[model samples]
Target: MRSSNLLKRAHSHNKQTLSSLLHSRGTSPHPQPDTISGHKLIEEETNPNYKPEHWYPARIGEVLNHRYELLVKLGYGMTATVWLAKNIHADGQSGNRKYVTIKINVNTLGEDFQKGRRAIAEKLFSANPQHPGYAHVRFMLDTFRATTKYGDHLCIVYDVLREPIDLCMKKFPGSRFSCGKLRVLLPALLKGLDYMHSECHVVHTDLKPDNIMMGLGDPNLLDHFVQHEHDHPSPRKAPDSHGRIIYTSCSDFGESPTEAVIASAKITDIGLAAWGDEKNTKPIQSNVFMAPEVILQAGWSYPADIWNLGVMLWDLVENIGLFDSISTEPDHYRPEQHLGLMIALLGPPPKEFLARCAKAKWYFDADGQFKYPKYVAEDCKFEHSIHRMNAEEKDLFIDMAKKMLTWVPEERWTAKQLLEHPFLTKERECYWDTPSLSRASTASVGSLIPSRQGTPGLGPTSVPNGSIHHSSLPVRLLELVPSLASSDATEPRLQRQSTNGSLKASENDEKSTSSSTLPLKPKMETLAESKGESNDETLHKKRSVSVNKSNESSQAMIDAILNRGKNHAPKAPAK
Candidate 1:
């Protein structure tokens, strides 16, 4: 009944109630035990009260704006909690207060949940540098951890959205909005979506009505998001009949929002959002909103969200889902039936795709189902007749949806491209004006630590550790030897010549000292006026190729002296 809070109460799950079926006692249909059982349905993420040791607690709510005090324990789940209370004070002013929503520790929902949510939030913020419209998305107020009575708690504060989209659609029919409103809303959705794709590198896998909510307005077209970091942009106030700032927000990330919500889209319900490198939040099930590729058990890509967009658009543009899974026969889930939906709309799966699928034995029939003339499943032709609108509107919406719903993932239109399409072009400039898809966005990175390098789709795989990488050899050697002009080992050659010159100079000095008895002028002049035989320039220029030991190291020079066995090179007895 209360749509906004009902769907937003994702972390607070109610245990199942016992109906009349449980009334079995002695005279009743079935016997009952003393222990009572109520529906506390749980899967991987059950509402956990378990506190592993060393996992301590800390208070999240601290110095606030003088009035509001966060009374703990509104609700909690596997990952986080929702706190409810009335704000009584203000930080800068001795002021009055109101109630709001505070969601905490959103990351522990799982690695994927944390990664995807932060990925998009960062993406949106980065995409539109100065837009206040995106400010409403629940993001970190500030982060700090401390010990308390419970355990570890990660926290965030948020504006509590009082109403959700399903209730909006229920309360106000198609008459509530018009072509004008859709023009603005569609591009907004695209801007948000484009930020997620190019900037965040994430996909909102689940989309439905309940996730969105009307923002701070009397409920008209002027809606936008708010978060701690986003300074609610100076309002461009367009008044509804009651004259209020039309503000709206997609409430949760539990699932991806459908594209049709360009008119009434709300992003909420993030419990099933993609986690880790994959959408490992929950097990796959038979859901109508899933793309055909998911149905075929093929891996999901970022484009999988586009198929969801097409389906959502189909629901809004026409009053029906393009592929209604609820009505699907059990057998329609198989490849041929899966293929049937595409044929009915996009026409047969491209022949190239069939050829590819043919090689994938697990997806096809083993006994030649494709070759049989009697094969109804394989050969059945699909009727793609459109009776809804005149040829133009039908062709336009259908063609656009097809681009968003392509079979091959690479061919699918990204949110940025979709926002730029004719369906949304009326407001394309408005969407691109703020332009939320930026290259510098950090969506492409998961963690700054060097260790997070390769783990599936987070980015590309890393090269092995042992790669020789010989290209760096010269560069590295140059770091050690600043003057090496070629592959010839210049330092070794120079040292070798220095040793030989020194030894020869010593001999000449001894011979000339005979001048102490003879003349020392000849040797002293020779030393000053003439370059020795090993001119440094001549040695460097020579295209010499040899591993001369004496040239290679001082150790070789020591060996030469040892061969002479020291004894001072047999100095000519004091002349």
Candidate 2:
């Protein structure tokens, strides 16, 4: 007993020493008043190496101010391209690789809808604003690069995140994360969402596993050898001669004293999210986890965010999305399954809510008339997949999940309510703290894949952005052909590059490419003038001229925006 007590005291003393080490660096793992004050002193600096390329930035060869070499393409969505890059700035002095992931969104020829969303992202980014509750989502590096696919797409240089959370968990399947870590990440995510909803008044509209990133454990995704700063810090290693280490760093751009306070995952991809899209009044992206109120065109609010948060929480706790309905038609996605999920867990929607759904044709109408179907199938049983769940577990998921994913947007759990839920409070385990979390399998999602047919509404008619002209997600793309190598998929795209940075489309690309890859109709005016079908589209648009040179929303863009306003002037808030 005496020896055991000595051991306990030794552990305590060592922990205190580690705390002092971190504190001496002026970096605290947790936000204490004194540490928080220190953060205010870190100022943004101009990295001499930063530069923008005018060419269609693809592959690792595109020029980034002629310093950082784009290495490997990490991932790409319809509109964004993620790449693993190496800092040429090192001049090979350290012989060590310092890597960062660059998220590039090309600005091809101007399309009103496309440009509008880009405009919002640009405006928010240029302001370079930070919310106290969020982890600092700094524009670590930025540059403008033109691409033929869209005309010059704005390329944003950011510190790349390491890997998918699922991939991380798989590596340590038997490991369990501690409650202290969950305390760190969940509050950060909530802060990001909260910032978007209240401060920016925009909804992410898309939140899923792939979008969330991890700092250490899964694989050194950002560890391209050179030192890089990421939101999540990497474990400390013995210092090298240069006094720098690779892989991880930290930031608290958004967090305040409140752990659950929402932060800035700023409503990105404005091509799909409009400022006044109160009712989801227009077309947008498709997928599971998107809230029903959003799909039904039934006037969504911050609650749509709650639905997404619920989906995230459930998956973290049980490793399964509550409803993961994929389809082959209209781009193989569905959100209507949310109703079935709702019904199974909370029982049928109240008649009044059903009435609201019935009147909304584009979202829930049957007969394949509108985009998504309204009603649930008869056998829907909202059973969660938590292995041997007891009654209390059922209450945890069914009650909270249902509350967050409720039919009436207003009825869903507010961010505050989600914080109060038993599931979040139950054990304090975080996805990160799980020791065996990294060893889990990616294929073993708790929920089985749903049928390809569910709700309606097609994905964007044109490729969204950064979506390879003919490519699906990289996961789906790689899966389509078992034998093709990841590098092989990119080789073909690189072969067509012009000596001067243009990608001369091959005869096959011209024919097979979706219409979105083609150049826009000749603009009678400059990019800003020709931005929107009318001004209404501008809600999602963010137009920027080379600010180092001029200031004013372009005439053509302004005219197009005004024109769109006539078609759908946003509905004013209800009394």
Model 1, range 499-548, lDDT digits (tens) per residue? 11221110001111000000101123233336554433332222121111
* Ten-residue stretch with the least lDDT total in model 2: 1-10
Q: Which structure among the candidates has the greatest lDDT?
A: 2
Q: Model 1, stretches more than 4 Å misplaced?
A: 1-99, 104-155, 174-181, 218-286, 317-319, 325-339, 351-360, 365-392, 426-575
Worst window of 10 by summed lDDT in candidate 1 = 511-520
- Cα error, candidate 2, residue 75 (Å): 2.1
Cα deviation at 485, candidate 2, in Å, is 57
Q: Given candidate 1, what's the lDDT at residue 513?
A: 8
Best by TM-score: 2
- Model 2 score (lDDT): 0.39
TM-score of each: 0.45, 0.48
TM-score of 2: 0.48
